[model samples]
Target: MKNTLLLLFSLFFYTMSLNAQFQKATAPVADKKEHWRNIHDDKVLDNYYWMYDYFGKGPDSTKVVDYLKAENAYLDATMSETKAFQTDLFTEMKARIKEKDESVPVFKNGYYYYSRTEDGKQYYKYCRKKGTLDAKEEILLDVDQLAEGHSYYAATGFEVSEDNKLMAYGVDLVSRRQYIIYVKNLETGEILKDAILNTEGDPCWANDNKTIFYTSKNPVTLLSEKIQRHTLGTEPSTDVLVYEEKDKSNYIGVGKSKNNKYIFIVSNATMSSEWRMIDASKPNDSFRMFQPRMKDVLYDVTPLADKFLIRTNKDGAKNFKLMECPLGKTEAANWKEVIPVRKDVLLQGVEEFKDFIVINERKDGLVKLRIRSLKDKAEHYLDFGEPAYAANFGANPEYNSTNLRYSYTSLTTPSSVYDYQMVTKVKTLKKQQEVLGGYNSTDYVTERLYATAKDGTKVPISLVYKKGIKKDGNAPLLLYGYGSYGASMDASFTSTRLSLLNRGFVYAIAHIRGGQEMGRQWYEDGKLMKKINTFTDFIDCGKFLVAEKYTSTKHLYAMGGSAGGLLMGAVANMAPDLWHGIIAQVPFVDVVNTMLDESIPLTTNEFDEWGNPKNKDAYFYMKSYSPYENVEKKKYPNMLVTTGLHDSQVQYFEPSKWVAKLRDMKTDQNILLLHTNMEYGHGGASGRFDYLKDVALNFAFLFTLEGISK
Candidate 1:
């Protein structure tokens, strides 16, 4: 026995010596850069496997945990070195905008207006009476001093009566579900009459201006019903059911004809929408379906003397085309196509003028306006090259008899309102939103680039940064993106982003799939079974930025909200090494669980967007990418997960349970902070300043992660 024990001891000692020697040999030669590259490549291969493999048979929990720990370590180190970079960025931004005034909305002369002030507390001048700074600023309504009950409550859809006697506004304070239609006496500042109506849909005023027609949904029946002829100064005299939509989709009241003869309604049941016309004169009448077989249809109908002017997608192209339809017709087939659809161009804003229809078209990313005469075959087109978006035709009050007004903006431009005379063919700028005094657009440059995804699909990315910025590879990058639904992330100007861009750090927007950046087809390529593409696309974007030496993986941070948050969570799991830090605000991370249950509100409608998980196919697909379900032992990066306790859209429990699960599974001791706002909803912040401060905090965290600042 003694001989055997001695032999075993000798063997153990020999084994220990060999292990120490092996550690010494491997430790110094690890080559962290090469090691990280191999790990990332392995993760990419694993992600492809996870996409196709059966949900129940996936990566082991231990493997996931190790990856997350590695990710956390990488982020922590990167954040430590770049703390000063972000501080410089924010400091420079504040210095640039120190002298500029903030802008606010004001209500005056029975119309809602805006005011800009160098200081936030004082109003400088009214928007309409700009250039007359010496004139005392007029106060139309003292919103703060108004009685609590009688005060306007979060008005959104504002419309003034024709005679300007009544101010009709929609308010929703308690719940976003219901909207209160309040008609107030403009002269007396008294609540003339208010009705609790369906706030989920838009509200329209009747031609007479005395009656209001709106759409509401009955929760019990789960049907969208129309409430017509709710007269002012009295209770609803008619409870006319214009149409009852049986599909569990949204139905909205567009508007009534100028003559108040017909009411137009649009119903989106699933991927497609249909337009219907109802005779307002016949209260008990059923709606006449205009285009039942139209796919991806969007139209704005305006009443004309004999025929109705219509803008629709009847043309085989993706852009809208102007057409004319006989009002008393029985079928949409009777409509005459006035403007043919063009293959390369997209018709945007359309409005009816005295004798012509003004149409805006998008050609090669530039916006041009064209006016077509209804009486003659004459057409006039105007080009304003600034990458204009969200163009709307507004009638000029001064030249209301002949000309129209157009408002548009781009990346560097603030909103500009322009008046165009149809008869004179001249355009004049009426008003331009001025950025606070010291802020300048010339300091930053905007560029568009494409990142190649795993499947070789080119994803568009918009980068905004200070000109002549160093390409040190250590520069901080805050990448933002949303890859869900058919929502398009468009190019628009933001004063708030100035706070980041001015700070030397680069800010980028990744236009991934699942968004309508390219079109509906693009969205479909990234949803459902293709959901993994969205996460992979984001990871590829980060990799591309690093590969191009624009920013190192250490200084790279990512952020997204709502559906975008879901993107952040998925990418965090798949390639945590690519990001130093992540911010997910009001995320829908608990996909499989939330989608499987129908009892949750808005579940039925969302099922069409995100497939019903009860089905075997959907269960496999959803479980594959569900962040909460896929959580395993991993080294996750420093993550700040935010949620609103009152968020009715994405339940608060999702983030709560997700954080708890992540805490249990994570192997690394990385910071995983959960900030829940008790008062806010899906937005997470309440007031404007409060939202800005929250944004600052997020930027602070990101900059800190990039070693920019504490």
Candidate 2:
């Protein structure tokens, strides 16, 4: 009898502990408030629209907070089994980082400027040395100290005056990207009383150290609306409004020429651009129009000693071209071709120097640097020797220097900095990323493959995996994509991704349309009326991977954030059986609703990318593919959707509302989870290590689904 009682007690305690660890908690059921949106002769009923009421402090604000908290609680309970695994993953990933790291110093204006991170610190210290690298270091700003108390803090736009006596920087405590400008007396180590609020972070200093030009943003919409000039130690309210952009769709910014001879205010939209310039010596002078905005044409101006270089898509140059215009005759008609547009090559941009120009061009989805001597027009392309890599011009602030600093990296290689002697054609590697716990590029293999799209267009896919992984259709693969805004999703190195690669996971990046990987035309085909192409292209890539025996449908996963999150949602709906799991971070899933609401941040600015839904044709087209709108009583892949409460780019309500609808409509019992960071914004945690926690959770989710605990 005693043995029987002891056995029963042991069993009872074991059951209790298991229940406590993984509780069968009920998922939060959001209250459905009837909300009807009628537009373009179409009416739609939204049940979770109350989520949008949080920012406005409406009656449902408390409900919104409560629902998000409840969802977080549910996620915690559901992922309880992986709590220890998550901590282990975080520590493992963090261990690979070199805690004490410093960036390569770049020479500019008699000072070598660089940033260094201390051990265990989440931010960096901006510093510079006068004359030489061995000179006593002058710490301009200690961001780790500045970000000490705030839960979310960002510092940007560090600019030093010509004399280097003063430094100006921008700070944002709220994480909304609305930065306040502050000046510091570098000699005295005192922060000035000048605080310019609600301005874009970058401050362009005039030749006169006291005057600074900045772009002021609208408080509500957070759009760059006006260029304002501020005199240090003066009241911000009394700052002079240098220029106000009347076009709501255009974004405006203020910048100074690299030679420190001109100050410019540039206004640009999706398809058009205009520039205004004034002499940097004359801060109070009116800016002259360098060029007027034109429809369907985009141009950028780069100043040189004798003339200005114009990079434009004028005359239907879909791949863009470089032209030269005399300083006095700054007009479209006066521009003459310097680098003619090529059918195969896309002239991305040009870096101007005293006697040479380095042209950034792309062909066949790879970057090529073309160096040309300004005196003799002798040009040569630099050899990178990599099949798939990203190389771009790094800080070449000194226009007279023959050495150009650039960064290079690939899917399997660590990011490396190099100084290329443009005249001698010599390249010297300065610094490479230190992946602490020892890493070798030869331990991995990277391949560039092409997948045929529905329209027969070839989409590039960059894949990296452990050296021994076989294409046996049994290994798991995580394919990522972000096909929007002509942003090329290049294959770059991330030390943290080794955690996945080592676990027999094949990681790949689908360079689908909507990105400029192939060229500008690739982006054009994936946006607006052709927006459906982006979705189809992603599906085709996944299908190709499965067809090629890289992975089976049961072990394939997909991940994307923001606009890419929209891609996740679209794929989950369009091809539900293709992916075993999906992770959408702060996804823009509510397309028609978000685009129709002009009051939302970035809505007006995205009119060209996502057509204005007020139009009848665009509304129906976007509605047809909108993730939230197309939610049906069907099975969806296991999903983990994340969002930030104060997300300014893609509002938190989007993902919140999306998860609620999926919970209500999705038929599968697959694990569907939402994790909302109540204190942060669209960018998640602001710390260097804090963001890794999020990554750990994501990785843990993937691992748990694969039945791998550690």
Candidate 3:
């Protein structure tokens, strides 16, 4: 009897211990179905490959959704302590925003167009007034009504007819970016029955005002391949296909010239571009090729009074230059230099007026606009006061107007619109965003600094902090980056970011490689086999900031989305101890898998950006740094991974699989969360105020790690 009692006691204690462990479980251990993939004599065993099952389609999708749900629940339960704090943060952030606001009205054609938000509305009400600003407003569409029944909503590509009676718009509710074009009679206030399905959302209005041209995408790959012509009130099924881009690697788009003289069909690849032109006055006419596609030559045509201006990289002009050719004689040999190529400056684009032309250029990773007189070819640049700022052309629909409308912003200033007279050089500030609850730009300090990379490249960093914040090493710092597609990360002000700054946090933007911050060569040096530089540059920036006493590893945090999320993952594996916490939004971590699958969106067109995995060398190189394949038994930072079920660009599975892999391998006990928004996409929440909820949740995660309850 004594032996039996002893055995029973031992069993009961064992059961109690198991229950305790279960109650304190940190994360779900994903089941492993290890699958072998051998490419170019290299091999990988993907354990969570089954997680790629389509969200709601396949038989295994239920398992996938359940697993994701469990992760969300785990995140919720773990962070339950911060729920109240999250609400407070959201409230504070929203309070700083002006509830009732209207955008600066832009005069175009015969009307002044603008959008306004009501005190409690989730979407904008698009309106316009004819003849004068004092005229009665014509509400074209109340977007909130269109967005009422959908969990996700977007209304874009609003183009008013030349006669100013009808407006064409595109609507997307699924978040997959497949938009349906709809036309409305602005004068009659009637929503037309005509609809065009599955377009790229941008439609070009012909001079006749009765027809529009739009590009369509392939169903599987989602590549814009065909341009179709649609006449108002006609069946979309009977629309004419104007042009088709036969090459899968090339993308096609249609637009009207600024002067509305020509409708252009632009076909562009990684290294080349071709333009087709048709007279806007003749909607029934076929397009004629302006210049045949050439290897290593990319150019865009802008129709001027009697000639066409071309921005081209011809004759080894890595940083493009401006060239001009007679309208009827647009051959390679007929091209004449208008603005000669400068090695140190990148000529971004040109905006033409009747008497002058505004050149958008970048120098030292900063944007400036140069106005040149068309009569005498004299030029001057617009003077922006700050060290790091962005100034670019806004809506200038009138080709003959002397006043140029542009937007300017910096790390310390709110977004401001200005009208600059090209001849007088007078800049009139039209409007500056209003930050409610008594905000002041003077309370912030902005600085521009550089971090040297391993290869002697100086990467720029933009820093902004609240006044009176110490530069001590103990201050918390948030480093943000996104370096891909030659997209530059500008130093723009954000009212939401004030939350972090007010909390004594320093925010820095690392203008790493893979971005065109320093021009084309900068982007070239960070792609393909040299792609590792992007990761190294970010890592070096973090280390340099720490060495400079900006912040230490204890309080350092990193954030990025999409391609930059890939950067976060690589750095986490390469330097796990460097960050205390990391936030990855809609990360594209499964590079090798996604690139190998041609059916995926953006894969076929981005072969030059990220090498084709079919090639032996490319496969091995990509496999070397692909985040999911690189995760090993290591200690990682506290991480919050977010994704949207309807994401069109970076599929939710990439991040889902990555988090599962990290959870299974990482040895750290730090928090790991996965928040899948079932209704949103690559860009988070659609509504202006609802998106702050995400920012609040992220802030709450960081605060929770620091034991901050407020």
By TM-score, who's the top model here?
Answer: 2
Q: Which has the better lDDT: candidate 1, or candidate 2?
A: 2
- Which model scores highest in lDDT? 2
Q: Encode model 1's per-residue lDDT on 1-710: one tens digit a residue.
A: 99999999995674343223111111011111111112212221112112111112344434333333443343334333333544554444444343444333322333435544443321133232223434444443333333244311244555555566665666555433455667767568687646646544346665466766676755532245454546666664344556666656444455655445677777764455667777655534566777673554556666666787776665444555777777677345776787777656666656665576677665543456788876786897876654334355654322124566777665666666787778788888876666664657788777778899989888888787888877879787888889887666666676767766766778887888887566445677888778888889889999998888789876788999989989888988988878878999889988866675555446666766678776768877887888877888988977887776546667666765576567667887455666666455676432223355456557766644443443
What lDDT would each prediction earn against the true structure?
A: 0.62, 0.91, 0.88
TM-score of 3: 0.95
The model with the greater lDDT, 1 or 3, is 3
lDDT of 3 by residue, 90-126 (tens): 9999998888899988888988999999887789999
List the candidates' TM-scores in order.
0.75, 0.97, 0.95
308: Cα error in model 1, Å: 3.6
Q: Say which prediction, candidate 2 or candidate 3, comes out ahead on lDDT.
A: 2
* Candidate 1: C-alpha lDDT: 0.62
Model 3, residue pairs in steric clash:
none
lDDT value, candidate 2, whole model: 0.91
Ranking by TM-score: 2, 3, 1
Worst 10 residues of 1 by lDDT: 26-35
Per-residue lDDT tens digits for candidate 2, residues 652-682, read 8999999999999989767789999999998
